[model samples]
Structures are given as C-alpha cells and as structure tokens.
Target: MNTKNEGVISEIERYAIKDGPGIRTVVFLKGCPLKCRWCANPETQKSIYQLMYWPNRCIACKQCILECPNNALSWGNPGIQICRADCASCGACTQICNSQALTMAGQHKTADEIMQIILKDLPYYQTSGGGVTFSGGEAASQGEFLCKLAKECKKHRISTCIETCGYAKWEIFCELLPYIDYFFYDLKIIDEKDHMTYTGVSNKLILDNFSRLIQAKADVTVRIPVIPGINNTQKNVEQTIRFLLEQAPGCPVSLLPYHRLGASKYDKLDMEYTLAELAPPSEKEMFQLKEQFVSFGFPVRIGE
Candidate 1:
C-alpha cells in the first residue's frame, strides 16, 4: 500500500526458462528509455497504466459506455471505441465488463507485494536452479523499486537475474550488481547514429555501461535482436563482433530473430506500429550471424 515503495509493471510470466539459468519467474516492469522500432512488447513501453480493448470479446454491451465517467467510451463500427486521450485508465469499465473484453495493462504494486508472488515459485527456483528475472520495458528504468525487490530476493536467498537495455545510469547497475546473479543485456545497435535513429537514444551510454560491466566481471549475456534491413547487415555484425571482442571477449551472445508476434498488441493499445511491414530475418541469416560471432571465439546461440 505504500506508494513510495511501489512500481508499475506490465505483467509477470512464471516458469520462464529462457530468461535465466533455470526455471525462472520473469517480472516485467513498466517504462523504458528506448523506443526501438521493432519492440515486441509495445504495451510495456509507457510508464503508466493503459487500456487494452479486444473487440472480439465484446458482446455489444453498452454498460462500459454507460459506466465510463469520462465519456471516453463510445459505441462504434464494431464494438466499443475508446478515446484514449480522454480516458484516465481508471479501470471502471473493466470492472463492470462481464465479458472481459477490456483490461488494464499495468499494475501498481509495492516491492513486498511482488515478493509474495515471487516466493510462490521458490520451490521451482530451488529445484531447477532458477530464480526470478526482472525484465522490462527496461528494469533499470525503475531503479529504486528494482533494487528493493532485488534486496528482498537476496534476503530470501533466491538467485536473481535482470534483463535490461543498459540505458540507465551506471549507478543503478552498481546497485543491482550485488544482488543479481545473471544479466541478459541488450546490444541492439553498435553504431551511435543508427542506434539513435532506430531506438531514439544514443548508444554511448549503453556501450559504456556494457564495458564497465565486463570490466567488473558481471555475469552477462549480450542479446542482439536481428531486424531485417536494420542491424542485420554484415557491416553492423562485424562492428558488433569487433566491439564485443574488445569489450566483452569470450562472452556469450544470444541472437533474437525479429518477429511480428506482438504486432497485434499495437492494435489493442490503439497505437501505430512503424515496422508493421518489416519481416523477420530468415533462419539462415540468423545462423550465419551466429557463426560469424562464433568464429571470433565468442559463445553464440540463435535464440533467446
């Protein structure tokens, strides 16, 4: 109930195997510093709560429109239309919708409240050598809240991991280093200009933090999402290999092939996806890239 210790989160995925070493629970924190064009989890980009309306689930009930105090809901061509600008995400309509066509995407929960959910999977973590993974829009965006949760996990002797973009201040990573057992850090674009062009942020900080992490000997796996016509070229891949060879030699790499799996999420959130037409790279391309990195003596894998 203490707002000061609370953080906004998109959702939590239990029994996740890819996030960390073992069977892990991934806590998806809300908010991000980057706006990558191919971001799959569009719902987690914003820092606040959002409404997700699934028209197919609507039963033509006008109760949502009637209960909406802000007049944000209105009957439209197919079902209920939400005026996002005027909607406050109050959850009033969601509470009254019996069909469950509408739902909120984020939740405000204190670190202790989240720890309760995490502890439920303690048995799995213990048996499988997995623990909890603090994933995000970028977990470092919620530094204080993340540190608090990590602290609690440590108290319970639960191994912890963090999946991050390495965009936040170095101080935040320092705070998490003591508690985090592993890290899944993203290195989207090696070039600063291209990084800013695609993700709306410079890669200087990301690179700097990554170097620092390597120097500090943090257990990290650098992940690269191979987007076609973007960072999938030989030049970018060479640059990435060179950088990793210099900064994180012999580090493990995970190549995440681009996919349109989350394209429908944009429609549900009523947002535009700039890369809707972009196609995922072929398996051959991913394997080639992996081989390239592997040739450099860096351990590489195809998927996350």
Candidate 2:
C-alpha cells in the first residue's frame, strides 16, 4: 500500500448513498474485462483518456478544429469531426471550446492524492455512518492500485466497499477481500452462452469467484440488473435464484431495474446503444421478480 502508487480513474463522485450503507464517495476506476451493452459508464471501460464529442452542443465552432495540434479535428456539416486515431486526448481543444461540446474521460491520481480529496467529506461519513466505495469498470482489473488505496482507507479506520463484476483472476479477488468491508457483486446471467452473447465474456469466472466468496463467508450482496429484453424474464430469474440458493442460501439480492440514464454517455462516447429502444422493467414487473426471489427464501431489495 504505497502512497506513491497511482491509478487511472474516471471520476470521484461524492455523497453517493446507494453504493452502500449510509453516505459514500464512489471512486470510479477505469478498465473492464466485460463489455456489457447496458453499461451506464461507458467512459470507464477503457483505461486511456478519450475525447467525447457532443454534436448538439457544437455551434459550428471551429475552435477545436483550429486548435487541434495534430490536425485530428475538422468541421463537419454542423458536428465536429474527430480523427480518433490521430487525436492525443491532450485537452487542448476542450480548453478553448466554450460550449463544452467536447469532453475528456479518465484522470490519473495517486492513492495519497485521491484520499486527500475523499477526506474532505470525512465529516459527512462519520456522522452518517458512511464511508468510501471503490467501483468500476471492474475494480478487480486494477488490483494493485485498488488494494493499496483500500488499505489506506483502512489505516484511517474508514469502511470500504467495492462494486465488482467478479471477472478477474481468483487470486486478485482473494487478495482484496481483507481490505474490502462490503462487496456489490454483479451476477448478470447464469447461462454461459447467453452471458457471452450479451456481455462479450463468459460468466464462468464470475460464478466461480462468487462461489469462493460465499464459501469464504465474505460480506457480499448480489446485484442483478433487470434488463427488460435480456435477463428479466421469469425463466432467467428462477434460474438465477436457484443458482444463488445453491451457492449461498439466503444471500441478499438487489434487483437494479434498468434505466436509460446512461444512454447519453454512450452518445457522448460515440458508441452505439444496443438497448436503444428497449424499456426498463415496469414497477409491477420488478416487484413480481422480487416476490419470486423472496419465494425462494432469499432476501430481496429493489432498485437499491
């Protein structure tokens, strides 16, 4: 846990309550092994700094085009042309542009530096029984940095929580258990074939890692995103519940009803939204699914 160790981060969000119990500051780490189509923070998937363009915000301002040192940007009809291959993400254009038509994602920070920023909200955490949550694009992928930073929090007696995709090497996940107090584990699908089709990776490792967590008796809470056209069906819900009961009986589950809140992020990153027209599950559907999990004797929470 060296203070000098640094990591690529997307954002340090403050006063987030839903990440864990009480008030929390969520540190969003960059990079992921899975490419879930419904990912809200598409910006966090890549560790590298990226330029984001918003066409609507462009007032045909040639500032970005003229200021780009590498000639990577050009004026296109009403939108800005971005030669991503040539662009360096140096923020030169973002600095000169006034409308915020362009943005950048990812920032580099050391464990010591980040804690200084997080410590500003220490009073809120202390009074509200809140602490810090390390989330991702899969915090496990950045094992060395995550562990070091979490240990620093431990040194200060601050509770630590992690939101993970459970897709990393078991060794990495195992080593992190000691530093993390609570885990928000995502279990998107039980079937390997469907899982790969949707998330661009197999769920075998995720399931295996979760099994170990249960066996280890770690404080884990399972989160399942209720994607309307994907895993929200009755068949998938029952299958998921059966698997959870078998591995960790009476384990708490939280059903995160899908929302289009991150849809704009995809637009910002110039990526296609696969679930573009698909709607989130209705309140009735979410409750019915909750009841189904409860019927199997597993404690359930909705949209938490």
Candidate 3:
C-alpha cells in the first residue's frame, strides 16, 4: 500500500522506552534547525544523504575506489578518504562495499511504507500503552509528510508522539496536534544570546511556540539537556524555570544530562567533536539540577 508520500529518515528504533510511555518505536527523521555542539544524533541534522565510514569494518578492499563515479574516494596515508568537494553521495561506493564499512545515513521512505512497519508492533503498543514516536532533526520541518504519517498512525488508533526543537511555525504544530498525542519538546538553552551562541538559533521562536503549545493544552513535556559549562548554569536553569512557569505552569520536565554517547558519530561523519572533554553530570548533580524545576511545582525527572 505504499502511499508514496516520500520522506527521508535516519533510522527507526523499535522498543524504545525513553521516547515515550511504555514501549515505543521512534522514527528518526532527518534535518534540523539547531546545530547544538553536543548533538546526540548529528547524522539526522543534514537534509541530504551523507556517508558514515566505519574504519574498523574496512577490509582494505579498494572496490569503492573503482565504483565511485567521481573518483571521490582514494587511499590516503592512513586509510581510504573521501574528497568532500568531489563526493556526490550517489551511494555507489556504499553499494559496492561488501564489508558494509560505508553506508548512507538517510533512507527514503513513504508514509504508507512506514505504516506497514508500525503495524508490526501494534500488539506490543496496544498492550504496553505505547506506539510510534516521530523523533527528529525536528519533525515539524517536514510538516506535510509529518501530517500524513501521523494521520495514518491515528487512523489505525495508534498513539503518536513527536520530539521537536519547537522552532517551526505555529501552523505546522496546529496541523499536527490532532494526530500527535504527545510532544517531547526540547528546551536546550534558555537565554537568547546563549541559545544563539550554542545552537546558532534564537530562543524567541522556540519560546513563543512553547507558549502556544501550552496554551493550546497539547500534551507536551519539556525536555532539557543539561550540558556542562553551558546551559547547566544556576542562572540559566533558574531562567528556564521562570520561563517554564510563565509559559507552561506545572508541566513535566525531563533533564537529560549531556554525554559523549554520540562522540564517535562525529568522526564517522568526518566532523569534529567539540565537546569531547565535556563530561556528563554526576547522579547528585543531575538530581540537584532536577530539583530546580521540581521546586517550581513541576514534575521533573533526571531522564526522559
């Protein structure tokens, strides 16, 4: 039944408990508005197809060198290297790599195609109070496709949720609210200057959208990533608490401590890991930070 509403996604993780209530399947969509230094899923940030090279899996085979249409791949001093400027990401090299050393990150899928997959876990979702969660690079960025997929989920009586940066237009959210039951909204940086400095985006749109979503009474949870030497500051946390109180009084908050879980991903993508040395907060610190929000009469936890 492949309803052919094409969309690009990085991966689909099933039986994910952290995405939402009970057991859930998370569809990791591609592309995002924010460029946070400590991004856990850097591969999802790009809209186009990109390559992830796992050097450990390389068998020293030069098959990719022969398959490359642009001759973009060549043997470097250490190993095979891809010329950033010449590589077209046509997946020729990826296809020829029998060892699965190189693979494309984004996969093109249709809503109907995805629905068939979602149906496979319907029993687990129904029994465990869980369903499909549309996570992103910011799901609202692909509003039309999101709406279509969400509609399909709802039509099947499947619970749908979204994890967004809250940086898109109000119309997009409005279009999705009817179908999406839960929203895992991220509130990374509170201060305008700090937000722009770290994520390369203003906090205004995000704040306004949060306010709108709260006012609309949509099922939204504020998820904060406590990055060390960044937004975890006492002042910023207090400011964030204040903002939350104003926009979404008593809303549930989840504090996700920054970790190096995605550090290796940067190297695979041929990018630098800026926060390589930044460590996650200790249990005590995480709880102390959680108390900041809890004190404001909001139900808060250390992790989502």
Candidate 4:
C-alpha cells in the first residue's frame, strides 16, 4: 500500500454529536508523539497493531495457543498468557478466536476506503449540519494520510474538524489549514516543566503552534483535560489563564474533566495505568474552572 494513501486507525465512529458542530463521523486515526499520562485513548497511542485480550470472553478453548504462528500464546493459572515480545500482532489468533476473546486494535485502511464509510453518513451530516471529524491519537502524526483524507472531505463539501494536541510541525498544520473547518486543540498544562512531566514532551512547540493558529485567525477551541493532582491546581490554572489571556484572548475553552473511562483498557493491553487511584474532578470543580475562563471574557464549556 502507498504510505501516503494509507492510514492506521482504531475505529470509524458514526453519529458522533459532541465531537463537532452537529451529528458527525469521527475517524480515530492511530499514532501519537506525546505519551500523555492521562490519555483516555491508550489503544491509539501506538501506530502499529496491538493485540487485545479479554479473559472473560475466553472459553479455555486453547484455540489461540494452537493458532499462534509465533508461539506467543499459552495457558496460565487464570487464563491464556501472551508473550508480547514474541507476538508480532499479526492477528492470526484473533481471526480464529471463536469466543471473540482476542482482537486487534489497529486497522490499515486506504483513504478511499475510509471515504466510503464517511460518504455513507452523508444524509445525516447534511441534515444535522455535521461533518467528519479527524480525531486520533493525534491526527497530525499521520500527516500525509490525514492531509489526503481531509482534502477528500473538502472535495465532497464535507466540513472537517481536527482534534489535535498541537504537537506536530507547523508545516503539517499549514497543510491541514485549508481543509479543516475547525480545530479542537488541547492546552493541557501551562508550565513547561509540568507539561513535560505529564505528557512526556515540552510544551514549547505546542504553545508556539497554538499561538500561530490564533494569529492566523483559525477557528479553534482550546481543550484542557482537568486531571486531578495534575493541572487542576490554582497556580497552574492561573498560569494557563494568563497564557491564554496573552496569546489567545477570547478563544473558546472547553474544560474536559478527566475520567477513568479508559483505565480498564490498560489491563487488556497489559499496560500500567499510573493514575489508577486518581478520581475525576467533580461538577463543582468543573464549574469553578469554567468560571475562571468566563471571568476572563473567554467562552467556556464543561465536558465536550
């Protein structure tokens, strides 16, 4: 497959309302540059295919162990065991698993293949004033494929939104500018050190890109994941408010209270969730945060 024409993705969700202006289709492209500690979509973090196993779904059929070409599966005390090192994520075992215990997270698809799915939702998009949203682990991480898909969407007069972390090159953002109608950009932490500690990357590039977007008059909604014990502190919020006040005054802000919805996914993928004990911010907390933004003359909304 031509790399520029193909993209690895987790799923194509139809009828998504919160992601964009109206009822929409959300294309979850796989791959990311930053490893945000509080990322809700762990499966999309890696570009390659990942094997997911559910113990409850396993019937002890041992079908997977027998099907493994890499000898990566075996029986353990409670259930089947996977040697991730040996496993190539070829998905042979998942294909043969009758009990639906095993599955692969990533799918390699051509832009045309994805456009077919998007076109199917045309009636809904037209009536609801919704369009396709290119979301991801980070849509910009798959630059070429994302540009191709967004270009195709525009050709069909489909309004497009990109939900991004703002960590990619400015050139990629430039490529996407003409095709994207709106951008849901994340502004997780204001302090550069804190940002690095939590998201495994410096915020310099992110902030720089955001500033450029603001200067360019791009329609962007800044999203902050209100994770407890992270960026929820008064000091951090103040810094965030100040930065936005300086660079992106009046830009709409979306306060997304952090949730543990994807925590269980860690276990399925055999990955550790460091914030397992952390709880989501309360309604009162969200309101207070919203008030901070609103008080500064910035439009704010909680949740999506």
RMSD (Cα, Å) for all candidates, in order, is 1.9, 1.5, 2.0, 1.5
Instruction: Indicate whether candidate 1 or candidate 4 has the larger TM-score.
Output: 4
| lDDT value, residue 151 of candidate 3 | 89
- lDDT tens readout by residue for model 4, 52-151: 9899999998989999999999999769888999999999999999898998999999999999999999999899999999998999999989999999
Clashes of each: 0, 0, 0, 0
Each model's lDDT comes to 0.92, 0.89, 0.89, 0.93
Where model 2 places Cα greater than 4 Å from the true spot, the runs are 1-4
Give the per-residue lDDT of model 1 (tens digit) for 126-167: 999999999989998999899989989999999999999999
Candidate 3 all-Cα RMSD: 2.0
**Model 1 accuracy (lDDT, Cα):** 0.92
Clashing pairs in 4: none
Best by TM-score: 4
Q: Pick by lDDT: which candidate is best?
A: 4
Pick the winner on TM-score between candidates 3 and 4: 4
Lowest-sum lDDT 10-residue window in model 4: 1-10
Residue 80 in model 3: shift from native, Å? Answer: 1.2
lDDT of 3 by residue, 84-147 (tens): 7898889989989999999999999988778888899999999999999998888777778888
Give candidate 3 misplaced runs (Cα > 4 Å): 1-4
Model 3, poorest ten-residue lDDT window?
Answer: 1-10
Better of 2 and 4 by lDDT: 4
